[model samples]
Target: MALRRTAYHYYERRLVATLPAERLPRHVGVIADGHRRFAREMTDGEYRASYEAGMRKLEELIEWCAELGIGAVTAWVLSTENLARPAAELDPYFEVLTDLFHRLPRVAQRLHFTLTVSGSLDLLPPDLALAAKAAADQTDGIAAPTMTVNIALCYGGRQEVVDAARSLVADLVAEGVAPEDLPERIDAEGLARNLYAADLPDTDLVIRTSGESRLSGFLLWQSAFAEFAFVDPYWPAFRKVDLLRALRDFTRRERRFGK
Candidate 1:
């Protein structure tokens, strides 16, 4: 049976209201997938419209956290694998990212949220990198209910680990240390500290849009015990209600810490 929009909305709202703000996760990670697909289904205009709407929804989510007194919100803006997309698709995405690079600071200022991009930034074009830097620098003054919004650009979990390992090995080689003795300093903590968003706290919750249930290698190590809430709505179609559902899911979860 086809579900009516009203009924779906009601269910989403009910899910949100049943969970208290006190049950909100301290750190939330969002995988904004299916944007390109959403754009394909709709016209170009609709695609851009959805992207803008998703961005606004992100603003609302961070505000939700600030209002609920949650700590951090990490968003998956792009993935390492996404860089391999065809040129036609890549062109538009790069444009959107460039626009977002400059626009995020203003958004953050309006919400007083801190801005940052995680992952291997070296993969981005020089101009885009500069814009990302600008956005990050503009938000150093947000004081009340400090919130961090991390955008994962050219980010991958397993790759990050491999890169970190390579770096550690390179440093050891430079120091004339034997390779066999590297484990003493190359522990999990060391590997974590070298990650793109290594400074951010571990994720408490991960939200993936577009009905996808898999992590897609978002935050491999950091989300070791993170709670997950998958949404059927596309990135552009997602709303505050979807975020509320994610929060509510976090509330009902029983985190056992792998006991």
Candidate 2:
């Protein structure tokens, strides 16, 4: 076991060394998937344990991104669709999520990153929403942060687009624009400006774990030209080597950005 661990570390170091800093992604998006399946398969349906492990893995992912000098990371921790699950299945997960939010501010401070929770907070349970907001507030005052972290809780890409459109319409109305002129005022760039994390760069790469090969509405607009890497491990089991491998693959791609 010790020998295998040593070999693994050596390989990881080599992989990191091979990646060109200039080729690394400026922004990364993660769809942290398969926690429930992992619980059923590995922990005999102990969901809280699986959730806790997944959250820990997320913290590790942030550290890894920071070390690589990635400018921003957007992680989808919970989705609007996920809220439809039975309370028995979701309550424990919510508890785990709330705990994660409580703990994340300290992590953000230590890592020198500004944290933002981007999602429909109105859709989440009151306590969970409050906890997430508090965490964001705690990290908002960081000065000249080294990186930015976005936690997508209760988020749905399509909903985000709809919200952005509504916001644009409201702004146009407030500006006293006539209804006919609204069509001309509304464009892709206009909608982009109203998105949840409008200030962040477009996603450069999106990583989804648990062998899923589809985006499923994650970062629907922002990832219009992002590369993807789908790995087989569940979120809880995702490793540093897995992330390194994804980064290596991203660096090899020739991105044309829709050209």
Candidate 3:
């Protein structure tokens, strides 16, 4: 075990040394998947334990990104589609997520990061929504934050596009644009400006854990040109080495951006 630990540390150091800081991604999107599976296999189906572990891993991920000078991270913790699960499953996860939100303000302050919880809040339980709002408020006062962390709760990429479209139309209507002329006023840039976090740069890299190779509607518009790295470890078991390797791989890619 000691020897294995020593080798792991050595490999980690090597990965860090090889990473080109200038080539690192400006914004990273994470699909934090497989918490329940991790719990089932590792914790005898105690999902709360798995959720806690995954949240801790997410915190560690933020620190790692900060250490590497990454500007932003968007983590998809809960999706709109996930609301369809049975209450027995979703309730415990919601409880865990609520606890996470309650505790995140302190972490955000210590890490000097701005936290934004973006999603369809009306669909969530009142307590969860309030907790998320409070956490965001607590972190909003940070002046010149070193990084921006977006916790995507109850988010859906398709729904986000729809919301952006609705927002754009509302603005146009408010401006007294004729309904017939509204189509002309609509454009990609206009819709993009209405997205949840329009100020942040587009995602440069997307990392999905638990061996999932599909995006499943994560950042559909933003990640059009982003590179992808899908790893095998569940979110709770994802190690720093996994992230470092993804970074190294990203640096090596010749991103043509759909040219």
Candidate 4:
């Protein structure tokens, strides 16, 4: 099984590399879905392997983008709806993601990628927020390529827009600003500044695993023109080859931006 998987991964990369430069996308996003179902399908030892392997697979995607000179990469680590998952499972889920968030600084240190998170802060427990913030700040002084690692937690693009508008309206009202003057005071760029990924690049591609077809309200506004790829493999079974396959598939599409 291991050998077969390894060979498949190699073949996928080769397929992607064969694409013309003009076929490639500049940015990529991943929806890492379905860890628990994978765990259930495996024995005790195999379960651990799948979990760890999935993580390394995620790292490989990041490394691949950096090597290919892709502009940015985003991962849908957690969605706003995911917060409502069963409490029994939620604790451990939070633990695993937060652990990754904290260790991301080390990965950034080695990979030269800047990391950022976009979502509702109200949804995250305080400590996880601190860990996320710390990891984000560590990149401040380091010089790296324009690689960006975006993690979405409690993030809904529509919700984000609503929140930004709400906050801006509150502030403007407090300042005694008139309603007629609002458009002149706050434009689209100003609204974007209030978004979770305000400073990050808009997405160019979004890959969702586990046979899911919808964005589930992901970085919606930012993903306006992003190429969407749905892979049949579940998140835990997700591999580097699948990522390359997604890229290869993306390469075949003509992103005209409505001409």
**Residue pairs that clash (backbone atoms under 3 angstroms), model 4:** none
lDDT of 2 by residue, 225-255 (tens): 9999999999999999999999999999999
Which digits, one per residue and each the tens of the lDDT, describe model 3 over residues 1-259? 9999999999999999999999999999999999989999999999888988998999999999998999999999999999998897789888888998998889888889999987999999999999999999999899789999999999999999999999999999999999999999999999999998888899999999999899999999899999999999999999989999999999999999999
lDDT of residue 107 for candidate 2:
95
Give the number of colliding residue pairs in candidate 2. 0
Model 3, runs deviating above 4 Å: none
After superposing candidate 4 on the true structure, give the runs of residues whose Cα lies further than 4 Å from its correct spot: 1-6, 43-54, 167-177, 183-187
| Model 4 accuracy (lDDT, Cα) | 0.76
Clashing pairs in 1: none
Identify the leading candidate in terms of TM-score.
2
Clashes of each: 0, 0, 0, 0
Q: What are the lDDT scores of the predictions, listed in order?
A: 0.78, 0.95, 0.94, 0.76
lDDT of 1 by residue, 1-259 (tens): 3567778778866775687767778789999887777777775645555566666666666776676667788888778788887776666667677887787777777777788787787888888878887888888776762778888878898987788788777777789888788778677877777777777889999999998899999888889999889999888777777777678768888899799
Kindly indicate the candidate among 2 and 3 with the higher TM-score. Answer: 2
Off by over 4 Å in 1: 1-17, 44-50, 167-179
- lDDT against true structure, model 2: 0.95
* Best candidate according to lDDT: 2
Candidate 4: lDDT of 136? 84
Q: Per-residue lDDT tens digits of candidate 4, residues 177-248?
A: 999987777767767777777777677888998888998887777788788999988887776677777777
TM-score of 1: 0.85
* Residue 110 displacement in candidate 4 (angstroms): 0.9
